[model samples]
Target: MALAIFDLDNTLLAGDSDHAWLEFLSTLGIVDGEELRRANDRYYRDYMNGELDMGDFLRFVLAPMAAHPRRQLDAWHCQYMQERVLPMITDASRALVRKHADAGDTLLIITATNRFVTAPIAVELGVPTLLATEAECDDNGEFTGRSYGIPCFQEGKVERLRQWLGARGLPWEDSLSTAYFYSDSHNDLPLLELVGNPVAVDPDKILLATAQERGWPVLSLHGSCHPVT
Candidate 1:
């Protein structure tokens, strides 16, 4: 069966869900409002410029919760997912996910966001598998803000997705003929190039330029239920 991989941030939703989650966390007293806001602004600039290092990025996002118990983080994530992320899902993205699900294709969400945050979104979307960054935990189950595996961003995304496919006995070459990938950032170039159908959804300038150069189809789901041609 064909596999359909989706980028979760701006591609699937109107904006970065991670940023929204952080904003929500700030309200919940789990994260410092000023610190998170400043860090997020810097993160966005670095990410857009392709200058974000995986380790640094992970630490920047998770460092605030290092002192908090893991249980509290889990609770905050669940509440954030239900109250903020779930309601922000766009109809166009949801319909696309449903289309792939109804066709029996393997629907996967590949994101740089930690699994703790992305898992609930994947479940809500009915996606079977999520390939995301794994944060390390202490013996007592407290977060260390360190990665147990490769951070799922830039080239790391391609590496992890390939590992996931290999473990499932799916060959990248064989699947390329029917595989589909949807993304919004230039950082996803490696994975996007591996698929036969590369779609740019609400692409940023870099992604838009890359798509144009590669002749990939560009799709816009903003403010509409149907994809703009």
Candidate 2:
């Protein structure tokens, strides 16, 4: 079976879960709405423009978890999933995932979002494997407001995926018939280029342009399947 790697944010879901999670917290009065919104928006814009400082962004995103008990954070996340994430999940996205699984492909969701935010979404989508930026936790199982290991953004995605494959005794080119990577952001271009089948899912302007120039398949999982050659 082939390896089907999917990006979780805009590729699989209709919106950015990390941003949505912060907005959800604002609604709950867990954070300073105006101040946090400004910073979040700036970071998001930076990310789209390929200028994000992952270290600063990670510290900002993980602070809430570090300040709260695990129980409280889990409670908030349960609500966040129901309220914010459920609406982002589209029928077409689910079908795409099911299509790959039905073909006996090994499904994996590789995202730059923190695992704390994307883990349940992976479970909800029934994808068995996920690689997300790790949120470091203290010995008591509470987040420490820091990220561990590689940030898993941009080129880091390719490095981490290589490590994952190597650990399983799998060679990059010979083990699978093909490796399919579906992504929407240009930030994932590194991993996308490394895969045999790089499909752009409702791509951003930069990614769409690159996909067209490179003759990669462009697909829309947000609605009816629109395939561009």
Candidate 3:
């Protein structure tokens, strides 16, 4: 079966889910509001500027929630998924996913967002596979604010994709024949180049310019109010 990989943040949703999740945690009083907000802003800046490492970013963002019970965090995650994230899934993106599903393509979400947050959204979209940053947990199910594997960002994303495909007896060459990738950032460049078709969805300026140079398809679903760059 052909593979269709989609990015989660700006490509699938209106904005960054990581930022939204942090904001949600603050609202629930699970995190220190001012500190988390400031850290999130710094992380966002560093991430866009290609300065922050994935592991560091995850630790920084999740540290505040580390003291909370795992069950409580999971409950909040479910509520956040239902209330905030679900409504943001645009009809156009849903249609794209549906078209791929109808074609019997292997739909997967490859995101830097944590799996705890993106898993429900993937299920809602009928995507069976998800490649995302995984947070480490203890035997008691408490988050360690650390990752067990490579955080799925930049080169780490490409590595995880390759590993996933390899485990399924599918190589990049085999997957690339009818493969498609949807993303919004230059950070996804490696996987974008590996796919047969690269679609830029509400891309950042760098990604848009690169896609333009390469003559890749570009799609903008949301209105002018949504930032495009």
lDDT of each: 0.84, 0.90, 0.83
- Give a tens-digit lDDT track for model 1, residues 1-229: 6889999988776677778877997897778899888887888898899888767877777775686787888888788877888777878888889888888898999999888778888888888899988978888888887777878898898889889889989887887778999999999998888889999988889999999998998887666534632
In the range 1-229, model 2's lDDT, one tens digit per residue, is 8999999999899999998998899899988899887998899899889999999999998888898899999999999999999999988888889989998999999988999999999999999999999999989999998999998889999888888999999997754339999999999998888788999999999999999999999899786667322
Query: Each model's number of backbone clashes?
Result: 0, 0, 0
Q: Write candidate 3's Cα lDDT for 172-228 as tens digits.
A: 787876799999888898889888999888888889999999999888755543332
Error of 1 at 151 (Å): 1.2
- On the 0 to 100 scale, the lDDT of residue 74 in model 3 is 79
After superposition on all C-alphas, the RMSD of every candidate to the true structure, in Å, is 1.8, 1.8, 2.9
Candidate 2 RMSD computed on C-alpha atoms after optimal superposition onto the true structure: 1.8
Among residues 3 or more apart in sequence or in different chains, the pairs in candidate 3 whose N, CA or C atoms overlap within 3 Å are none
RMSD over all Cα atoms, model 1: 1.8
Ranking by TM-score: 2, 1, 3
Q: Model 1 TM-score?
A: 0.93
Query: What value of lDDT does candidate 1 attain over all alpha carbons?
Result: 0.84
Give me the candidate number with maximum TM-score: 2
